[model samples]
Target chain A: MKIILDAMGGDNAPDAVVRGALEAAKEFGVQIVLVGRGADILASMKAQGWDTLPDGVELANAEDVVDMHCDPAAVVKQHPNSSLVLGARMLAQGGGDAFISAGNTGALLTAATLLVKRIRGIRRAAFSPVLPTKDGHAILIDAGANAECTPEFLLQFGCMGSFYAQKALGIESPRVGLLNNGAEDTKGDPLHREAHQLLKRAAEQGTIHFVGNVEARDVPFGAADVIVADGFSGNVLLKTMEGTAMFMSDMMKQMFYRNPLTMLGALLCKKGINGIRKTMDYRETGGSIVIGISRPVIKAHGSSDDAAIRGAIRQAIRAVESGFCEEIRANIGQMILPREEEHAE
Target chain B: MKIILDAMGGDNAPDAVVRGALEAAKEFGVQIVLVGRGADILASMKAQGWDTLPDGVELANAEDVVDMHCDPAAVVKQHPNSSLVLGARMLAQGGGDAFISAGNTGALLTAATLLVKRIRGIRRAAFSPVLPTKDGHAILIDAGANAECTPEFLLQFGCMGSFYAQKALGIESPRVGLLNNGAEDTKGDPLHREAHQLLKRAAEQGTIHFVGNVEARDVPFGAADVIVADGFSGNVLLKTMEGTAMFMSDMMKQMFYRNPLTMLGALLCKKGINGIRKTMDYRETGGSIVIGISRPVIKAHGSSDDAAIRGAIRQAIRAVESGFCEEIRANIGQMILPREEEHAE
Candidate 1:
């Protein structure tokens, strides 16, 4: 299987992306097509003491670069040869089985949606990010794709998210939970209340495994395999968790370095601290997968390092192999109830 | 000067409530009125070996208790003499300057809104929780009060939140931020976008010190004095932070207790750890204050210990002394643009 990487993306792009591609090629035995400026890619490879391109690796030259601040809608028209757009084009044309980028999230999502297109029956593509939990990891869908979602959008998110969890993470009949303020069915705003009923119906019909409402506090405790929410609330929850984790880690570090005795304690506890940090690290999960699209498109973090890039590659390979999109296309009908019938209720 | 307490509320019940009220009276030198079953209050006081009630302290009899599971809307009619309802009635009748409860949040909100009433022109009461930040604290308004909000409601939340921060927290000009997914004005759903425009106009009019949009990640870093969001997102952000904090603390504890070496490290770093813990403690901030009401009404945490209850009392006293509600009433006109003009815009 061939995977396409956006070489001129992310904060540590070109160098880190090239190196990670090489590592993934060598370790995973997958062919990697790096799309970026030809000279820059070669220079980055040479910087790492590579005399020539290795086997199972190739390059697709693209002259332009898409900055983080670029408009998502304007990227396709303006930066036609940008690495992000080129990579998406390559995947769309069947040149690569999957595509990955660590560039502008909006631009990437736009490119994937416009280029590869959404699945025939899918209403909108959802961004599903895997977050680490106590015992396992849970997938938070619609993390930031559609900020304003209807009940129908959320129902599709549940279906798509459950499919990804089962195919990618290998969670059979993944438990799908609606993210809400409280665990009661009566909780949440109008959208959630409506979505809850729709999801409950879908679950009863065996479209997905529907757990009851899961509160934010219970999210980190492995409450469900797939936690579904509108992009607005899901984005807030995801970012808040990230911020709190960073704050606590920084506080712990400051505490440990306050005095000589504490510094000594820090030294003694280094192993355990590292373990916890590793558990919380995003590099392990690679990035968020854009679900409901025609093809697999993984979005690595913009600040992704070599390990994160490699993780993204692994995720892309698994997505391609699992035929996750096929699963969604086959089962999404059962998840989405007809609008007329929905309104009739 | 008088503060009413629902002694029959919270997980700790009459014991912790009585002790906290007694401590608040002694520490703040303020009058206290404990409302609960008369016999239970006396027994709890006796259990604490306080043969006589302290000066500036009194009790009001309440026949029923509002349990956590009770419906908020039903509490007023079903349990009219419940501690929560009776306490609100006391504040409404001018028997106390402020009311504090650690009972059912929904019930407390309902009782306070129905009995104490909303400030003139305020459409709805909002739950504003003071969250501890690295430097100081920030108030998250509409934390869990109104799940579905109009642009008008959010504008009021901003107005009320700004005033509360200025009067209660002593910020001369509190910076009110609209909680959103992105900092850009163009970002977020329709509601946020409309609310953003309204808040911006309010800020331009010098009604609030509006600091554009604030993402959830920036909330913990004290990006704004008042972070205003619809209750759904606000509740999610609040709970996600709590969950993340708990997860980190638990992980740290597990790491420290992994072996003797780490345990020794933990002992040596106890002071520093305690300092960080204290900084992150919710007890220091008391609890969420129900803003937009006629008088000060503070909702303490259900599982609050003595310290949390004491903190809540201090907050209530501060709110009452600062004339927080009066401050909102006096300046709310400027904060809320005329509805006709709002529609015109």
Candidate 2:
């Protein structure tokens, strides 16, 4: 299997990406194609004591890095040889089985849909990631992929989320829940009410285990393995959790370091505290799989380190090994009958 | 000032309530009316010794306790002598300066709205609570009262929130922000877009200290002193924060109990840890204030103890002393002049 890495993507990009890919190549024995400006990638590689490319690693030269401020569509259209663009193209052309980037999320999603394309029956792609919880983890889909979505789109999210959790997270018959204002069908807006009906129908037919509406409070408790919402709410929910974790970490530090005595206590329990921090760290989770794509495409964090890069590469190899893309294609093809009425909209 | 305490409310109820109220009465020199079944209240009071209802404390005649499962509106209407209803009535009739209860939230909100009534200029009432954060705390209004709200409602929430912060939290010209998908007014749904415009107008005219849109990620950073959102989103946001906190607390506990060495370290810093826990404890923050009411009405936690009840009474006294209700009325009254003409359907 071959994986293409956008070495210019995150905050700690070239160094982290190079190191991660090298680690992944050694462990997984899979070819890694690092696509970026040749000189920078090579310098990063040489700095790490590599006289030449490893047997499993190769370079696909691209000239530019997309600035955070640049218009995503125009940049992708114009900068054909940009690292992100070239890396995406490699996956589309069968040069690599999977693609990974931590660059502009909007651009990554857009490129995946437009270039890497979607499974035949998919209406929209979702950026679902598993949220950590006491019971375990729950899948939150459409974490800012499509701002607006239909009931049909939500029903599909349930199907896709359940498939991913079942394959990757080792959950069987994962219960899917619609993220809503209330647990009752009569409690939400017209859109949620309609989606609730569709999900109920899907559950009846056994496509996915629909557990009805789940309030935000229930999401972090792992009340349901899969929770589906529109991109706007999902994105806000995901970020809120992340920001809150960061906030608590800061507060815990202040609480410990308030005085010399507690500061000593902090030192004594640093190992235990570090364990909690590691569990909360998103970088260890690999990249969010751009589900509904024809091939595996993972979007790592921009600040990803060497460990994160390797995680992403391993994620790609696992997806291929587990036949994730094939499972998605089969599920959508079998369950979703293209409705002419939807197309008319 | 006299405060009504629903002795039957909360998890630890009578014992915690009895001890907490006794401590507060002795410390704060405030009159306490322990309103519940006479026998239970008297028994608990006697347990703490120095009988005869004290000089400042008295018992109001209230019979049955409002259970959590009871229908809020039905119970409030049918059982006029229920602990919560009587407490609200006492506050409304000036029999007591404030009302505090740890009974059913729905029942409290219902009875308070029906019996106590809202401030003259306020259309909707909001539940504003000070949520714990890394940077001390931040106030979130309209946590979960009215699910569907207009832009006008959101603007009023800002006014009420700002007043509470300035007077109660002791912040000058408290920064007010509308919770949204992004900072831009053009972002988010039509409701959020309209709210952004209204908040901008309020800021321009000096009605509020509108600092524009603040995302969920910024909530923990002290980005704004008050976060204004419709009840649905606000409730979700509030619960999400709570769930995260609880989840973290549970994880920390597990880590502390992992080994004998860690357990020993936990014991050494037990006092400091207790202080940290107290700081993070939402119970210490008292009850959610039902803002926009004619008088100070506090809805204590359903599982509140006597300490929480005492804290709620103190919070109510502070609310009254801070002139929060009056300020909300004044601010909202000014906005009504032009709004009456341009009511959005």
> Which candidate's lDDT is highest?
1
- Give candidate 1's error at residue B7 in angstroms: 0.6
For every candidate, C-alpha RMSD to the true structure in Å: 1.3, 3.1
The CAPRI category of model 1 is: high
| Each model's lDDT | 0.91, 0.81
DockQ (CA atoms), all models? 0.85, 0.43
TM-score of 2: 0.91
lDDT tens digits by residue: candidate 1, A31-114: 999999999999999989997999999999999999988999899999999999999998999999999999999999999999
User: Which ten-residue region of model 2 chain A has the weakest summed lDDT?
Assistant: A336-345
Off by over 4 Å in 1: A342-345, B341-345
Which residue runs of candidate 2 sit more than 4 Å off their true CA positions? A72-75, A78-80, A180-190, A254-271, A333-345, B47-50, B73-75, B183-186, B333-345
Give the fraction of reference interface contacts each candidate recovers.
0.79, 0.47
Candidate 2, A279-334: lDDT as tens digits: 77876677788888888888887778888788778777877777766787887754
Candidate 1 lDDT: 0.91
> lDDT of model 2 at residue B336?
53
